[model samples]
Target: MAGGNFMHRVLSYVINEVVVNGLANSPAFQRFAVRTSKTLEDISVKASKKRQELAEQIKEASRNFDSFKN
Candidate 1:
């Protein structure tokens, strides 16, 4: 059981070191970061438009409901 615990700790340490080094050294990470930033910006713009449309729909539904109640 102790051996298993030690091995787990060692493996975890190695994996973390590799990940830190890889991010620090990799060109792929840089490209991914740029791509992700652009994608996020696009998603933000689309989300804002969708939110506005949803608000309009909700307002119309509320007005219709109010008319029916009266």
Candidate 2:
């Protein structure tokens, strides 16, 4: 029924406004967001370092193969 649909929309809007806006207004949530961002950045940097190391290892291996052909 139309009444049920109206109530559903109203309830959904209230929940979105309260939960989303409330968390954004909270200091604890802000701290959590900062920590999560830092952790992700650290992981990204570590991964990039590992990738570069692997690339260097591959280059060294390819050189070994080239030297063997002579």
Worst 10 residues of 1 by lDDT: 24-33
Best by TM-score: 2
Query: Tens digit of lDDT per residue, candidate 1, span 1-70?
Result: 9999999999999999999999978999989989999999999999999999999999999999999999
Compared with the true structure, model 2 gives a TM-score of 0.82
TM-score of 1: 0.68
lDDT of 1: 0.98
Flag clash pairs in model 1.
none
61 Cα displacement, candidate 1 (Å): 4.5
lDDT of 2 at 25: 100
C-alpha local distance difference test of each model: 0.98, 0.99
